[model samples]
Every structure is written in C-alpha cells, then in structure tokens.
Target: MPYIPLEDHLPGITGLLEYSKDTAAPIRELTQTLLRGPSTLTEGERELIATIVSHRNQCTFCVTAHTAAADILLGEEETSTKVKQDISTAPVSDKMKALLTIASLAQESGKSVTPESVQKAKDAGATDIEIHDTVLIAALFCLYNRYVDGLSTVTPTDPAFYKGLGERLKNNGYNRLPEGYEHLKK
Candidate 1:
C-alpha cells in the first residue's frame, strides 16, 4: 500500500497525481515542455537524459517509465538498454555522452557541473540551449524521482505494461492524456 492512501489501482506518479491534481497539472506541463517540446535534442535524447538521471538517482519507477519513453522515441529498445548499461560506451553520439556526463553531475549536485563539463558538451557540438535543457531535465528528474519514491507509490512489475504505456505516450504526446488515462484526472 502507498504511504498515504491514494485512489485504488493507480501506479507510480499517477497515483500521487490522482491524490493531488493541483500538483499534478504543473508537473505534467513541465514534463510536456521539457520532454515533448521542440528542441535540437530529439524527444528520445531528452528522455534518455531523464532515464540516465533517474537511474543514477536509483529511482526505479522514474527510470522504468522514462526508459520506456526513450525506447519508444528511439524506435529501438536496445539503444536505451545499452545507454542504461553504460552511457560512456553506448552507441549514441559523442555529444550525448558529454551531456549525460553533465546530467550525472547534476544528479549528484548542480555545483558539480563545472565549467569543464560545459566545455566538453560544447566541444561535442552541444549548443547553449541543449546544455541548458539537459541540465534542466536532469534536475527536474531528481525532483520527480524523489516525489515518486518518497510517496511509496505503487510500481507495476510487468514489463509489457510499460511498453504499452510507452507506445501510448509516443502516439498521444504528453499534452493530452492517452485513451484510458482519462480516469486519472479529477
């Protein structure tokens, strides 16, 4: 059971959102803008940043959720699995590795992202906006990870469930709810 009683059958952050819609709206909006918004980084790349940070933070729900998102966006489950296994050696571009480094540091402490880290990202062709967004996504996930874990929310163990949600998220985009998710709202 959740640490706080939430509506029945909702999982992970969805449960918390159902418990509190006022808080959920802004979080959803921020996620929509950060992960779904247009940018030099592909939606997959941004979701990769979230996956990396969530994994580093040891937030299982966030990691699983974002990894599913990344998998759908990248159109290959292996790509995200490789990155999750080892970002430095993953098949992604050099720029992505450098950005993941910055995200890792942000997971530890924002102050750990030194000028050198910024320089490395720049060297790898990461623009100012890309760097800025990477840091934001990393930092935002720290908050999200803590929120989900802190609440002791339910996390489904079924892999197929996540894969299905991933496809739903990719098709619908974060601005609108997926077909069955209407029940999540107040």
Candidate 2:
C-alpha cells in the first residue's frame, strides 16, 4: 500500500502522477524531452542511464520499468543487466561507458561529478550536450527514484506489467499517461 491513497490499478510513478496531474505535467514533459527528444544518445542509452540510477538508488519499480525500456530500445536485455551489474564490463561503446560514468557520479552527488569524468566522456566523443544531458538525466532520475520510493507507491511484481510498460514507454514516450488512466484525474 502507498503511504497515501493511490489508484490500485496504477503502480509506481503512475500512481503518484495520477495523484496530482498538475505536478505530473511538467515532470512528464521534461522526461519526454530528455529521454525521447532528439539527441546523439539513443533512447536505449538514456534509458540505461535511468536504469542504472534507479538500480543504485534501490528503487525497484524504476529499475524494472527502465530496464525493460532499455531492453526494448537497445534490442537486448543483457545490456541492462550487465550495466546494473557492472558498467565497466557492459558491452556498450566507449562513449556510452564514459557517459554512464558521469551519470553514476551525478547519482552519488552533483558535486561528485569530476572534471576528469567529463574529459573522459569528451575523449570518447561525448559532446557538450551529451555530457550535460547525462548529468541532468541522472539528477532527474534521482528525484524520481526518491519520489516513487518516498511515497511508497505500488510496485507490481508481475513481469508482464513491466514488459507492457516498456513497450508503451518505447512507443509513446512520457508525454502523458495512456488513455483509460485519466479517470483518476477527474
């Protein structure tokens, strides 16, 4: 059960968003722009950043949801698993690894991000925008992880739910909750 009442059908951040559409709008918009918007980083790479941050934060719902999204966008499940297990050994390109390192540092703390890590990413071909986005995404997801877990939102155990969510995220991005979930806002 959530710390506060929430829709039974909706889980994780969905429930929290439904609890307040006013707040959800900007959150959704920013998430859509960052993850789905045009950038050199693929959606898969961005989702991997989210997954790793959620994993580090121990936010179960986010970890599962983004892992599924990463798997779908990247066309492989193992990449997420490997990243969660160890980014150094993950099969992503050198640029991705460097970006991920920066993301990880951001997860630890904004100040934890170092010049060396930024340099490493640039050396691996990460643009100024890529470096900027990686840190922002990491920071955003940290807030998200805390928001979801802090409220004690529903976290479904069913793998099928996450798989479907992954597909929806891959196709729809985060612009809005899917139809039928809007009733809660009334």
Output the number of the lDDT-best candidate.
2
lDDT of 2 by residue, 99-132 (tens): 9989999999999999999999999999999998
| Residue 114 lDDT, candidate 2, scale 0-100 | 93
Off by over 4 Å in 2: 178-186
Q: Compared with the true structure, what per-residue lDDT tens digits does model 1 show for residues 82-180?
A: 888898889999999999999999999989999999999999999999999999999999999999999888888999868876876787766546454
lDDT value for candidate 1? Answer: 0.86
lDDT value, residue 33 of candidate 2: 90
Which residue pairs does candidate 2 place in steric collision? none
Q: Write down the TM-score of every candidate.
A: 0.92, 0.96
Minimum summed lDDT over a 10-residue window in model 1 is located at 176-185
The global C-alpha lDDT for each of the candidates, from Candidate 1 onward, is 0.86, 0.92
Let me know the TM-score candidate 1 reaches against the reference structure.
0.92
